[model samples]
Target: MLHHQAIITDIKAIIAQSQEKAIRTIDHQRTLMYWAIGERIFREEQQGKDRADYGQHLTAYIAQALEPELGSGFSKRQVELMRQFYRTFPIANTLYSQLSWSQYKLLLRLDSHDQRTFYMAETVKNNWTVRQLERQIYTNLYERLLVSNDKESVLAVAQNEQLPSDAKQIIKDPMFLEFLGFRRESAFYEKDLETAIITHLQEFLLELGNGFSFVARQKRIHIEGDDFFVDLVFYNRLLQCFVIIEIKTAKLTHQDLGQLQMYVNYYDRVEKLPHENATIGILLCADKNDAVVRYSLPAGQKQIVASQYKLYLPTEQQLLAELNKELYSFEKGE
Candidate 1:
């Protein structure tokens, strides 16, 4: 009976493996087909550069004609996408099916070859979905890397395995939180924001950058005679530490810092495993007193960090301005 069961398990495993292999093969073939269409369209377009309007019309004409014969994938937009796809990646060997059409569209918009390559490599290495890839690009992931890391490390992250130590190196301080759509001028409570974050946990984590995995919402701790709760607890696989996060809707104060310090101390003393490093704390507040944070924490302390969150996505101009600020500081050797 055991032998029969083993044989059945082996058969099921084989079937699963075959199915996965077949899926990969189909994906590869479909991507190659798209690349071929792109190549043909691009070559034709190049020959008629003098007739600029004709180029757009040609794609629509081809898509309209192909629809009845070829089926669903050939819309006018998709045909234009095919042309852009070839223009973006002329080398068919480099095209990866792991990246969807949406991701390709986003990548093709990047002006720099190195920037596009970096994002492609990271997106594949991290297995980021189309939405995740778009979010990273829109958030200026490439620019953020240029600001935070040396060229070598930045390239390594873009090309190779995403190591845990590199998480903070990639994270942007004062991450824009405008996606939440909270009114800065309104009297929204901290709990209100926290609830929203919990409701949209996946988006929140993506905005939080990489390496963070949600551990708990309102995690409880008991110390001596009192009970305390942390708003969020996450573990950064790369940093190898438990991250205790405190949320505040108002400006950060010394008292807030002290409370976070207490949480960090508690985790270090009681909750942290022997192999794990000391816990780190983050104060995600609506506002911050940078001076208070600087003087309140011990010098050269890497464990605790304070960053403000925004509830809306900023304009491209705002993003560029912020990028310039980081770049200027780096150039000044600050």
Candidate 2:
């Protein structure tokens, strides 16, 4: 019986490892294939001798021929994508298949090469889904970094693969939680939201903005004679620490910050492993006062963050208005 159990365990382990390797190999091959396609398109364009009309005609011709054989992804739009695929990444060998064609298409749309490259690298490293990539890009993450940080440091983090010490600062929060299918301005108990997040934990993690994985929901911690249940706890693999989140339906207060501080301190001093970094706390509130947060937290406070979350996805106009507001505040030295 024991021998059979051992054999089963071994087989399962082998299967798991093989699946992982196969996925990587598939990604690598797909990446290489796109590179080759791009190369072929480039060569054809070069043969047309810098004539834009010839390039379009050739693409149309090729699309007509290939569409019947290759199906939908080979239409004129795809051929254009292939051309862009090569133009965006001149070196075929540099193309990585770990990221899908859609990801490349999004990156190609980005005006800034540095920003695109940064997102590409991070997407590969983090295995960001298409939705996550879209969110980050739409949020103007690159612009935010350029404004908030030193040029050299920000560029290095974006381009040279230098992981920022304060990665939390780069992580946005209250991150468009409308995916939960919750209505904005609806009154609900905090427990209801917590339960929903726990129920749809995977979606919640994606909405939480990067490097987050579920650890516990309403996790109980015993201290002295009393027991406190943390609303949500997650661990960030990239950052190497526990992230404790407190959900608030009301406006954030100094007391809330103080409570979160205690939780963070507890995780840091007692729960965190010796090798792990200090725990970080986030107050996910319906509204936040930047001035209050700044005054409540200590100086050089990198561990705690307060962000407002919306239950519904904002419309384009709403997003634009928010962006204008942010820009206006920044301009006014707020």
Q: All candidates' lDDT scores? A: 0.81, 0.78
Identify the runs in model 1 with alpha carbons over 4 angstroms from their true place: 1-28, 41-80, 179-184, 289-291
lDDT of 2: 0.78
Give the per-residue lDDT digits (tens) of candidate 2, residues 204-263: 776565577889888898889989999999998767899999999899999999999999
- lDDT string, candidate 1, 1-334, tens digits: 9999999999999999999778767877777788899899877877885657878978999999997788868988788888878878889888877776667888988898878887898788778887888888887877776775765677676575546464446565667776677775777777888888888888787778666799998899998889999999999876788988899888899999999999999999988999887798889987897779989999878778787777777888898799889878877876
TM-scores for every predicted model: 0.78, 0.81
| Candidate 2: 10-residue stretch with minimal lDDT | 142-151
lDDT of 1: 0.81
Find the number of clashing residue pairs for candidate 1. Answer: 7
Q: Which has the greatest lDDT? A: 1
TM-score of 1: 0.78
